[model samples]
Structures are given as C-alpha cells and as structure tokens.
Target: MTPPELDRKSALFLDLDGTLLEIAATPEQVVVPPGLPSLLAHLHHQLEGAVAIVTGRPLAQTDELLRPFSASAAGEHGVSLRYADGTREELPAGIAVPSAWREELEAAVQRWPGVLVEPKPHGFAVHYRLAPEYGNEVWRLVRQLVPPEHPWFHLVPAREAVEIGLRSASKGHAVERLMAHAPFHGRRPIFIGDDFTDEAGMRKARELGGIGLRVAEVFGGDPANVRAWLMEGAQRLDGRSASSIPTGVTP
Candidate 1:
C-alpha cells in the first residue's frame, strides 16, 4: 500500500536507530547528520505536532541525539511516553525489575568482554552489538538469569540485543496511546522503522488505517534515503511543488 502523503493530516512515528539514523557499532556512537534537527523541526511544524520519535532508546538518550528540537516520543520500547504537550507517563512502579535481577545482569555483563548492560527504570537490556561473536552467549545468559515464568518481565530480542522489560508496555501500546490524543486522534498514522522490535508499531499503524514503510531493499536499505525522503516531504509541505521534489522513493 502507498504510504499516506506527508502532510498535516498524517501523524508520523519514526524509529531512531537504523531508521532515522544509521546503526553504529555502539548506540552512543551513532552520528546525527548536521541538518537532521532542523529537518525534523520543519516536519513537526508541517505536521502540526503530529510527528514523534518512537524508539527503543531512553527519552534522555533520544533527546541527547536530537537536541535543540524535541518532538513527542515513546522510549524504552514504550515503557515511557511523552506527549506533544510535554506531559509524560511511564510504566508503573509495580513493573520495575527486582534488585536481584539487576545485579545478576550486571554480573553477567562483567563476564563478557564487549557486552554492555543498559538498565532502565522498568527493566534492562544486554547489548552485544560490539561483540557480535557473543550474541548467543548473551542470549543464553539472559535466559538463564531471567526466569522463563517471570510474571512482570518478558524477553524481547531486538537488533543485536536482548531486552527484558514489562510485558504490558510495548511500541504498539505507545502508538495507541498517542493516537488517542489531540492532533493525532483523527489523523492517519505512518510508521517507519527497521527492526523486529519495530514490527509492533508498524502493525499498530496499519491497524489505525495507515501504512508501515520498512527501511530495507526497497529504499536501498539506507537511512540516508529515509532522511532524503523526509527532507523532500518537508519541502513539499512548505508549499514547494511535488514535481520539484526528488523522486525514487515516496514517503
């Protein structure tokens, strides 16, 4: 299906790593292009506050990467959410990981040379991106450390990482919550992402009468192309003719 036009009527939800920005060896090492902040600001204006970054990164990290302009966002796979008006919400305190589990994860990471443990308010993640050879090891450790029948937490295998978080909160839930509010309530939802974790948000977008554009072979599997498409969309929204916009992939 053709994606909804990038206009005021559509609500745009974008993933961060590997979608808006190229994936780096380490999450902290990803580079934000010079003009991306400005471009995103323009798109947010054009969409009338319908633009948001739906990402796995924490809100603080997302803000650090896309500084000078803050859009609505859902972070930590939807464990936290900040609306357009700046109101924030997060998974309840009841869902937090136990201290014992946190210690176990930290100890496990110490055993792996390049593995990193990122602890969130609600859960934790073991990233093996830097040590690809230890991916299976990381997964195995997580499985053994975290009980299979844990009531509140569940394991989410994402790109080069395994995240254990609240079972209830998810990208799909995030999208649903955003769509229930003003500006986004009536608008069609468009989700752009490039990972298995993003599939939830993509499916939610389609359920809301919009399309999900996967960043893969179709768009050259490059985040640069996604950026170009966004820039062109912003330009078109600024009253430029569609014909003046570069063609290839349409967002």
Candidate 2:
C-alpha cells in the first residue's frame, strides 16, 4: 500500500529492528547510526511528543542505546513499557522463563553451534540469524517448548528468531496503552515495522484510523530510507520543503 502523507496530527509508532535499524547477526552487534538519536528527538519534538518506539528489546536496552531521548516505548513485545514521563510498567506479574526451558534452550545451543539464546525479562528468544542453517531446528525447538494454543505464552516470530513471550502482551496492546497517555491521545497513529511480530501493531494502527507501512513495500527494506522518510516528514511539518532541508535536527 502507498504511504500516507504525514501531517501535524500524526502520532508515530515505530519498530526498531529491521525497520529503523539494519538487522544484525546478533542483537548486541546492531549499531545505532550516529544521527539516529538526534533525528528521533527532533521528530518527537515535531510531533509534540507523540512519537513512541514499539520494539521487542527491553526498555533498559532501548534507553541505553537512545540515551538522552528516553522517548516513550513498549519493550519485550509490550510486556514492559516506559511512558513519556520516565515512569515504567511491566504489564505481566514479573513473568519469566521457566528454569527448565532456559536450560533446555541453552543445551540445544551447544548442539546448534551458532544459534544464540537470548534472555529477556519476560521470556527468552532463540536467534538463529547467525546460523541460518539451524533455523528449522530453532523454530521446532521453540514450538515444542511453547506449543501453539498454549494458554500463557505464544511464539513471536521475527526475521530469523522466535521469542516465547506472554500471549497477553502484544504490540497492539502497547500501542493502545501508549496512545491513551498524554501527547499521543487524540492523534492519528502511523505505525511502521518490518516483521511478522509487527503485524499486530500495524493492524491496530489501521483499526485506530491510521496507516501501517511495511518496510519492504514502502521503503525497499532499507533502514536508511526509513530514516530519510521520517526526516522528510519532520521537514515538511517544520514548513520546509523537501528541497530545502536545512543543516540538521537538534537532539
């Protein structure tokens, strides 16, 4: 679908991995471009603080990377949230992966060699991005651990990874929660993401009278393009045409 023209009333919900940032072999290996922080901050300012990041990574990790911005965000697939005010919330009852499950996954990694076991506050993810050959094994093992129709947890599939997160927690719920708060409420939502897990958020955006843009169709699956698109929106909102982008956006 064609992307809508961004406007003053638009509230933005963005996904980090594979959308704003290039997909990396491992989560830790992902590098934040030098100008991303400032660009996001400027966009946040332009939107009157209506911009929020909805990512699978934990809020602490998001903060560590974005530093001073500390924009409102949903983390751990929406199990955790940090509002625009710096207050945080964990929607689940401190739910964590079972010891047996972690041990089993860790053991499987030894056999898989390049597969990595990622631990989260709410659950865990098995990433086979580094070892694409083990993708089937990783997916099979995750399904075996938390099968479909499991009452408490569900599988969230990303590029080459699968996470076992609470079924009750989702990007859709996260978007709703964030939109209900100040600066975001009473505005149109524009959600952009690039994975199966992001579908929920995109769907919710459409339901809420906004647009959901897929990275592949809209920007040719390039993070640089996403950033440039956002900058264009900000410039347009700032009353500057695409041809007259001035020096830079201040953080």
Candidate 3:
C-alpha cells in the first residue's frame, strides 16, 4: 500500500538522488543536503532502528554522503548494506557483462556530444543531462549494443540516463533481504526515490506492506528549487527534512 495507508509497524526505505540530495548534471555534481544526518539520527530514534537507504549507488559513495549520521546504508541497488552494528555485507555479484560490449558502448558514446558513461562493477550508466536532446540517439545506440533479449544483461532506465546491468540483481532484492534481517524486521516498509531505477524498491515496499515516497523532480531546475523540493519530500517521511535523518541512497 502507499503512505498514509500503511500500518504503523512499517519500515522506511529511501532513495538518494532527487529524493535526498539534489540531482546534478553529472552524478558527481549532486550535493547532499546539509544537516540530513542529524535528521536521520532523530528519525532512526523515532523509528527504533527500522529505517535504511536503499539506492542504486555504490556502498562507499552512499556512506560518504550520510557520514554525518553514520547509520545503516545500502548501495548498488541493495547489493550491499552497512548495518547498524557496523558490519558490511556485499550481496551476490551480478552477471558480468562482456568487456568487448562495454568497450563498444563506451566508444559509441563518444560520438554523442554531451553523453558520458558511468562504470559500475556490474553495470554502466550513460548520462545525457548536458544535452537532453541527444537522449534518444544515445538510447538507440546503447540498446543496439545490448539487445533486449540478452539473457544476462538488460537495459534499465534512470532519470537522465540508461543503465546496463546484470538482470539477476536489483533494488527489490535488497529490500527483501533487509526486511528479513534484524532491526529492520517486523516494521512496515517505506521507500522513497526519484528515478525510474527506484521503481523496483517502491514496488518491493508496496508488496511488503510499506510505502514509497518519490522525491520531487531535480533535472534542469534551479539549485535552490531542487534543494527545497528534496527537503519537502524528506519532511513527509521523517516529519522534518534537513536535520532529521542520517542520509544517503544506496543499494
């Protein structure tokens, strides 16, 4: 079920970009909202340790953004998690894409004036925010490089890019695993995100009896507006936006 209709004993699953931090031209340009860590800490206390960030980012990156709060963080779309006990676990590695295919896609991206590729252990992201008009062309080429029927790899859409990754892993799997684990168990699931990649986590939360709160739009908007939108979304989930939760999006 959606938020407001969720049962009291639910968990909180949040997204990072567009949801917590404002989105940027490049992935690296995104800024973590100030004071989010403190807000997360308070929310954790309020929830009794039932909250966590479930995102598509890598685990280390997620931790860096939420360092101030130092709470549990998940990365690689839930393929990894840093628990409240300070333990780390990397979920199963995803299907390996052929190196030749990756190279071919990267080389082809160079022809696109404003697109850039983001490399991941099991996936790649083609970003086109700098030139939105090139998106369709970039997508067409990327799709050609990785066919839809490919068994091990698939193309997943994000806000400003398309991601190619192992089909076996996803944010949904992470939510399932986290829900079955300690501190996060028995609580209702609540997920927040702002991209198409986050849809899996949102669906998982709904299936598990929780809610997904999608962050406001962030692309091509004023920085101040983006920040305000992010803060507003956070406030809905935690009752306060900036200083209410240990922040980061991962897994």
User: All candidates' lDDT scores?
Assistant: 0.84, 0.86, 0.70
Comparing 1 and 2 on lDDT, the stronger one: 2
Task: Compare candidates 1 and 3 on TM-score and give the better one.
Answer: 1
TM-scores, one per candidate: 0.91, 0.94, 0.79
Report the C-alpha displacement of residue 73, candidate 2, in angstroms.
Answer: 0.4
Leading candidate by TM-score: 2
Alpha-carbon lDDT of model 2: 0.86
How well does model 1 score by local distance difference test? 0.84
The best candidate by lDDT is 2
- Stretches > 4 Å off in candidate 3: 1-8, 216-251
lDDT of 3 by residue, 14-69 (tens): 77777667678998887765666655665576667777887777776777777766
**Cα RMSD to the true fold for all candidates:** 3.5, 2.0, 5.1
Per-residue lDDT of model 2, residues 81-136, tens digit only: 88889888888776677889989999989999889988988888889888999999
Model 2 worst lDDT window (10 residues):
242-251
Q: Pick the winner on TM-score between candidates 2 and 3.
A: 2
**How displaced is residue 158 in candidate 1, in Å?**
1.2
